[model samples]
Target: MKKFKIGYRTIKTAVGACIALLIAEYFDLHYFSSAAILTILCIQPTKKKSLNAIYTRIVASLIGMLYAFLALELVGYNPIVLGIMLLVFIPTLVSFKFTDGFISSVVIIMHIYNEANFTVSLLLNELALMAIGFGTALAVNMYMGDLQKDLDQYLKNIEELYRSIFSEIVKYLRNGDTSWDGKEIIEAANLLNKAKSIAFKDVENHLTRKENQFYLYFDMREKQLEIIERVLPKITTLPVMVQQAELVADFMEELANNVHSGNTAKKFRSKLEEVKEEFATMPLPENHEKFLAMASLYQFIEEMDKYLVIKQTFRGIRR
Candidate 1:
């Protein structure tokens, strides 16, 4: 037999379903399958999402039972009464923002017709199933593995891409190097998107009032990359001004070194201001080509300043 590797969430969900079944059997509930079904439905990827699922399902189950009881007592059990009950309750659950519980509520309504009665014992049975299903899901999700390491790895990837991008720009500015085809920008954008998704999931794993710094960090990088994309094309047509290119290349190299450092944002901003001042003091470009080159250099400096400002919003220094 061949073996397959299974994900942690899949394993957790399977365990939760087994636990729910055992608990339902221990309680002598008539519907152990219902508990198992709820466990499967409630086993979400994040603790926060799981908790929300359990809450919504529990509330919807109660509402469903109430409708069942009222229908049995007033209209008496019939296909027409069940239809009316669904017609009334589905919209009610939707209005209360409990749409996620619609299918679970229908299951509860089905149980009433299955047993052909709405007695107190039946109510107790549904409650037991609910308790077993949701409790097992909560227990399984309590152990969220360390996400900080994964988030850090993602940041490191983004930083390396930043280094590549700036290095290419430096090559172009210095000797009009056209070897690089600006592919790094697209790669960095894709990485940033993936990092943001992972960070958002990490936020959902933790139940807290505090913001997820990893998510914020990626978001900041995304904004910086936008500025970089704008600056890349500006360098493509610049006249080779060796002295200016050397300065810009050196500045970019330094900026890449301190990409993940929070303490250096202020320093970088100061250095950029000095560069801008130097451009102001320089003599006017003698030709149209030289003028365009100077204009592109000035704009690049301004964009670098904006990039540093975005980085300043991140919470911590890179490890």
Candidate 2:
């Protein structure tokens, strides 16, 4: 059944056109044959290129017919004159890579004239051929059902990846390690890379189906992802500086631990005060106290990560 459906459409169209042509022959209806040919060949569901093909075929057919009519009028109904006209026009059509049906229609129009006279019957034949061809293709496409489900899924995945990267960054920062010490940076980079790969493949494979306008967002995100990745290595330096500050904070924590354990409180309090003052006075990136508040966030995250680490560790926390 699946195989039948798969091959049925093309065979059905050919048979339909065959029957029309045979009927025209039996009834001595030449115009019906032309229209049957036109219909079967002109209509197809090629999506992006369908309208373009139809317009070009229509134009080419008209040119060929017009030239034939002009030749017939100027030179009269001579066989030699018709032969010479075909020689001149056929190459002109072939030179431009027009479809077989388009060029054949011209030849057919040149030769498909009635034995009786110029009549409405001839025009109807050509028109009917085109209608059948076009209608058959459209029917086949509709029967195949929807092919756009993949496009929707692709868009959804892209949006989800974008939001996931942002949310993960927030979670990593909450650890107070601005240096991006954990898995956050790597995970974001990997996911972003996957996102780009998916987008590129989707666009490349289905440019006809994809929207050109939506591509702007894809390009923008790609560039931003590259910049963020480049900045990541620099963030590593920030953790080193924060780790130094964390050492003092760890010492203060230890002192508090010692004092709680009944060690001499006076010396411990004195040292704790000194360490706290030094930590508070740590120079900003720009060496300005006012700007200490403006210190690099990456550095602060690392410093805080270490501070929290020791605090947690002293209080018997695993991480």
Candidate 3:
């Protein structure tokens, strides 16, 4: 399969950092490199996003410096105290949202503080450096186009997740066993919801300028998710269908795994024909709800089928 890939975030980060360094370099910004570095580091490509990142960084930086001083005062150069500080601080950095930002600010503060060799100086230095770093990162990200791209990527993830669920359900309907990893299902659902929430906030924040396509696409997505929620429970009954549907899922899995035909379409077609035979002849739904739901299941399959066709078309175009 031809994979769609982009590193806009990394590229933006690198360029932003480069520009920041040059800016600092040209103007002799004492904290320029660190500021540029902060811009790169605080990037939300991997996390809560720009505002959260900025907030976390500032909070963490100040809090961390406070922690540093408390540690220093309490431990006071004792090997045991330093060790304890390192132990607590390391996990704290990893665990807390802005600990890394704060710790970094504190460390820089410590350097400047020791340069002046005073506690008050250290605090001032920390605050100054954090402001620079946070400000620089903030400025660069504002102009750069990573956030929209990030939202698109997030939407893509959600799309893949729902598609995967669709595929799993297909397997269940035909194979009679729905025993896939529950954790995976739950994780994908939870994460996509979070991503959706984040994307919604971002779109709202940039409503004045950002594209309306985001809104339209996500509106459809909400419908898709609603359909999925209704359909997901139908999958729970698959264990009873396993004896009849075993070959059904196997074929679907085989077709799904084959991103490229290599003339495997013949085999896939044959397998699909066989599935139609089994599914067509299988016991029909006993009630209106079951029948409507079953019809909807076909609609879900129809969507996947249509998607696979599109995937194939795109592949052909790429080739």
Candidate 2 regions with alpha-carbon error over 4 angstroms? 1-48, 72-120, 138-148, 160-282, 285-319
Candidate 1 ranges beyond 4 A from true positions = 1-5, 317-319
Ranking by lDDT: 1, 3, 2
Candidate 2 vs candidate 3: the TM-score winner is 3
Total backbone collisions, model 2: 29
Candidate 3 structure quality by residue, lDDT tens digits, 78-151? 55654576677666767775565654555554554344333674456445556666666676566544456666
Clashing residue pairs in candidate 1 are none
Q: List the residue pairs that clash in candidate 3.
A: 60-102, 61-102, 174-245, 175-242, 175-245, 176-238, 176-241, 176-242
RMSD of 2: 15.8
Summed over model 3, clashes come to 8
Worst 10 residues of 2 by lDDT: 310-319
By TM-score, how accurate is candidate 2? 0.42
When summed lDDT is taken over every stretch of 10 residues in candidate 1, the lowest stretch is: 236-245
* Best-fitting candidate, scored by TM-score: 1
TM-score for all models, in order of appearance: 0.94, 0.42, 0.44
lDDT score of residue 271 within candidate 2: 53
